[model samples]
Target: MKKLFLITITLLTTLTINAQKVYSTDQSYKADVKVYVVDQEYQADLLVFKVNADYKAKGNEGKWFFTDAEYKAVKKIYFTDAAYKADLKVFFVDSEYKSGWKDKSKQHFMY
Candidate 1:
């Protein structure tokens, strides 16, 4: 029973660490990552899907759950007006299945 409980705890911890819980900051200086929304899908480095629940925001596979408070977020990001000013360029997709990194080179920015 104790071993089972420990395994469950470890699994939950791993899930929580990989969860894409993000907070949007108003100030660019306060953000961990600067993001820009691209007009076209092909112009984006990442295809993002906004998940309805926090638990659904698993992995750095472009699944994101926006947190209300900064303290609850794994990453804090600021939206940039220009793609040149941004650290990452993203395009929001309608479906979760469509979410993924187009440029695998920029994948480490989320981690």
Candidate 2:
């Protein structure tokens, strides 16, 4: 039981560390998060809450500070031309609880 508990904790920690911190990048490096532009808020896979400050940001919310340099970004994201090209299909929800991946298999992209 203890071994399983430890493994769970370690896995959670690793996932948190590797979670994407999205930054809109203009350059050539492959984006960690490939975003799609949905016409309706309901069409999005992740309902992104844009927080004013990075410190205030929690969970999926944060200040997406656009960086000229690709390396500076924690997670580089590009807007896909079509929804099919996107790794994850997102819908912007009004409430925090509403935000999540439409396809559960692609949940790993956000975290």
Candidate 3:
């Protein structure tokens, strides 16, 4: 009985953590998170992996839906032309596990 219970809990926890739905907001102030695209991979605070489908995007992997309105967005990001002008700088990674925040301070922005 204990083993079964543990398995159930583990499965539930895995599913919850792996699920990620992100929305890019039009306005920065109304956004849950702000992001900047860095010119070089070494300068990024987070390494992002954009999956083709929402289901394929898990954990740090994200499938972003850009919304016209602030209220409709789950997370808001303003892409700055320069890294110095942005808040959180990110680099696009190739895999999910490799996709994570290099700067621990910026970690909460994604979740």
Candidate 4:
């Protein structure tokens, strides 16, 4: 029983550390993201990442989508692209978000 308990704890710890901070790079998609508005700018509070909200990016979706030049913050970020001046979406990683898309479906990995 003692051995089993220790092993279980170890496994759980490992999973928690490596759990991917997942989110959609597209704002239109809205992948359980936390939207924020600040001083005529929008930011996504993504986890496992550091994002920048200095300018409005062109695209807002996909894996290889727009990542903040500063990758130390969150998932992605954007301000207002002149024509579209308004608060943008700020996608972040949270316990609530974790379960949001958990039931959706995993993308097939082909490598």
Candidate 3 has a TM-score of 0.61
Candidate 1 per-residue lDDT over residues 1-111, each given as its tens digit: 999999999999888877899999999999989999999999999999999999899988999999999999989999999989999999999999999999999987888
Q: Choose the strongest candidate by lDDT.
A: 1
Sliding window of 10 residues with minimal summed lDDT for model 2: 56-65
All candidates: TM-score: 0.89, 0.59, 0.61, 0.23
Q: How many pairs of residues collide in each model?
A: 0, 6, 0, 14
User: Which window of ten consecutive residues has the lowest lDDT sum in model 3?
Assistant: 60-69
Candidate 1's error at 56, in angstroms?
0.2
Local lDDT at 53 for model 3? 62
The prediction achieving the highest TM-score against the true structure is 1
Query: Can you give the lDDT of residue 16 in candidate 3?
Result: 52
lDDT per residue as tens, model 3, 42-78: 8888777776665565565444434455554445576
Number of the candidate with higher lDDT, 2 or 3 = 3
- Superposition error at 111 for model 3 (Å): 1.9
Question: What TM-score does model 2 achieve against the real structure?
Answer: 0.59
lDDT of each: 0.95, 0.58, 0.65, 0.31
Per-residue lDDT of 1-111 in model 4, one digit per residue for the tens? Answer: 999999999987654333332333445343333333333212322222222331221122211223333342234333333324423333334233231121112211100
- Which consecutive 10 residues in model 1 have the weakest lDDT in total? 12-21
Q: Which regions of candidate 4 deviate over 4 angstroms?
A: 1-24, 40-111
TM-score of 4: 0.23
